[model samples]
Target: MRTPARRTAAALAALLLCLAAAPATHAASPHRHRAATLDDLARQHGRYFGSAVDNPELADTAYSDLLGSEFGQTTPGNGMKWDATEPRRGVFDFTAGDEIVNYAHAKGLKVRGHTLLWHSQLPNWLTSGTWTADELRAILKSHITQVVKHNRGKVFAWDVANEIMNEDGTYRQSIFYKTLGPGYVADALRWARAADPNVKLYLNDYNVEGLGAKSDAYYALIKQLKAEGVPVDGFGMQAHLALQHGFPNDVRGNIRRFADLGVDVAVTELDIRMILPADETELAQQADWYGKMTSACLAVRRCVGITLWGYSDGHSWIPSTFPGEGAALPWDENLGHKPAYDAIRNALTAARS
Candidate 1:
């Protein structure tokens, strides 16, 4: 037998817990009108500010909740990659990619396909087996065609080829390059175009933000491709910077140079990593750098947008990938805004004004 007062207190406790467990429904909040999200500010300047995400991350309601509210576009981190989309040579799977596409559509956001061809994360059947030039070309065409065709209307763009250049600016000797020769790039691009002419095709790479040998290699390749009438629409500079190495030199100039070649440029995977145990001083520096990177993109006419590798440090790939190096995003593990967040906001706000 419980007292009425005790029973009321017990009921209240259960209600509080239920509310805590439920995800934030900002639509019903009285305060949804006041705040300006990154995407909103970006659109004012005629660009899209986005983040990369995967299927598993959707399980974290808080993460997904923020993503839906803040981003206007999303890149499927690994769901649309070769490994996930076509594990078997002839067989195909769209389960992972479709989940992300459906999520983005539900949230009223656009989707960018990560990659149709890459040197890594390839299915074993494709990588392990040896092939003649003709044999390899058919497989490559089939893969790109099926993937692009499957997501034709859903994905607005595709990273048609990813990380295909060496640090010294040489073409990476991927299986495609070895078996089908340099023409493989043109062939793959053509196949993707045939599959979906409307989808924008891009060649994405890291360490190309600055004027360096790696970027130079891409410059020459794109020029040649354009001269030959190849369908190269964009160049993706993956701004995966580490504070320890210092920011890339002449980032804006590099973007402009590529843009002059008649292709849109984007900061595809933007993240600035710092050494562990970040102090106030280091964080402040990180914050300033974030603002500078955002400003760089705004300065260039053909620089289309910036997509953070991931928005929260909690979901960032830095810790495990770099070991001792983390804290590489605008938000911390708890989804709290870090100094970098304010810096990015200020940069975009200034542009709007």
Candidate 2:
């Protein structure tokens, strides 16, 4: 016969096994229970889910497959920029950009033209050459007109100007600003509109997800642009967040204010990074922030979409740019979904409900 202690131990083991076999709550398995893709969930609320991708990442079968399957929209990370589109002054090359456009089309994904103008990554010829205001204006017009015209129908939106304002609400001393003054902003938008009237034009920037000097500057600028019929359609908030900096306190309010200005807003280039060696607490906090951002966008009708800078940590630009800081995406380096992924799905589901 078995002893009383042995009998009690057997009963406890059986109870533990029963608990392990039971289904987890929604809180525990947010992504596991959901069968709908993110795009599908967003569509119910009339929003698009997207990610930015570099040209090289397309070569990875697994990476590309997940990108094509999960997201409904894609932005070319570097292919459509001034440097890649026109490596030589007046000599345009669309090979890299075209590759991405074709891939997006084949996958039935909408494309967002990544940036017609920026201070950095200009071709050496343009940077090296010294030109008068008139010469630069003509070149700028040509570049914007041709680039937009070439990708006319393929792209639904364009980041016409990016990072043009500093944190103090002053224009950066870029060549375009120095040579042509702030008139370049209006000229760029008008030129793009004239080239393709259907494409939505946007001014994109980083660190403007909340009320601040930088975003306030954009509010005034966009208001003036709209009043003067400059064809401004949207503002892109590049939410390149970091854990240490803490989440923006007024992301939803910020987006609402821009939408009230009679233009759409997009959470573009979003990635939440933490310091090296991410732990469970940091990852859980990351998930909460991701859900908050998604809910913020969904709360605003004019907030059209949200796009991750890159979908996976393996290809994220964080490690290279911010050393000792990585794991900034919803997917791990091995393409497995991270907690942020479930958080996003749950957020979308909650929004739809």
Candidate 3:
């Protein structure tokens, strides 16, 4: 026997919970409006941005939600590789990468096929198997050929080589380097170009942003690649920056140096992770960093796009992989927009002005 007032309150509570539990509908509040849409962003900024997604179910909705938004492209987290594409040498598995590519194609979003070759997350068989340098080169050729041919035109670009330089401006001594020597990178690019003449190819790396020795090393490689007629098309600067360590003040000069080489430049994986949710000072610094990075690109004709690694702080790979790291995105875990989003939007929109 509940009092009439109590009964009414209980009914209201249940209704509110039901509403909260239901998946969002179009009529929903700011959540829907805040959800970043690809069409809206692309049309508004006329620039490209993207994220790496792993699941197919979320991939479909995320692409649909963003179909025509600021982010006009998408990439797979760990697909389009020897591990995912050809895990057991001869057998190839296109399940995950294909799902992402098809969804982006359906939504008319440009797709960037990440990492044809990387030192990390490589298949163990590729590392462990006793293959001669010739055998390895043959395997590399076949892998790139099949993967490139499979997704040909759908992928707007491919990271033909990744992280080849050490922090101190020397070759990182990857397996390709160890087995077949320095020419391995050129060989991979040649094979990839032959497989898909239309695909824009790039060399991606981190911590080589400013005009330092590392940057000089990459510059030499780019020049050599051009001189050798390797069909190289772009350079991807992995801008995984931080609040504590701060960004290189000469970011603009760094980017321009590469673009000056007659190749496209992209901030391939841009994120600024703070140890904690931003304080007032941190927020201002982040906004400034975002604006500066954006300004540099907008000023450069060949700087094509700026892609965030993930959409939100919650899903950022920083925390799990780099302990004590968090809050490295333009959105929070709840999908709430942050100051960084507005900062980037303002930068891009203002850059056009």
User: In candidate 1, residue 277 scores what lDDT?
Assistant: 91
What is the number of backbone collisions in each predicted candidate, taken in the order shown?
A: 0, 0, 12
In order, the Cα lDDT scores of the candidates are 0.92, 0.95, 0.79
Ranking by lDDT: 2, 1, 3
Top-TM-score structure, candidate number: 1
Tens-place lDDT digits, model 2, residues 59-91: 999999989989999999999999999998889
TM-score of each: 0.91, 0.90, 0.85
Best by lDDT: 2
| Displacement of the residue 1 alpha carbon in candidate 1, Å | 54
Stretches of candidate 2 above 4 Å error?
1-34
Model 3 TM-score on a 0 to 1 scale: 0.85
lDDT of 2: 0.95
User: In candidate 3, what are the lDDT values of residues 1-353, reduced to their tens digit?
Assistant: 75799889999999999999998756557665585453354345555767666554353454336433546777776767668888888788898788778767776668888878888877888888888899989988888888898888789899989998898888889888888888989988999899999999999988877778888898999999999888899999888889898688898888888998989998888888887656878877877887787778777778888777876775678899778777787877766777887887777666656
Model 1 spans > 4 angstroms off: 1-32
lDDT for each residue of candidate 1 in 15-124, tens digit (9 for 90 to 100): 99999999887666876565989999999999999999988999999999899889999999999999999999889999999999999999998999999999999999
Q: What is the alpha-carbon lDDT of model 3 when measured against the actual structure?
A: 0.79
TM-score of 2: 0.90
Q: Give model 2's clash tally.
A: 0
TM-score of 1: 0.91
| TM-score ranking from best candidate downward | 1, 2, 3
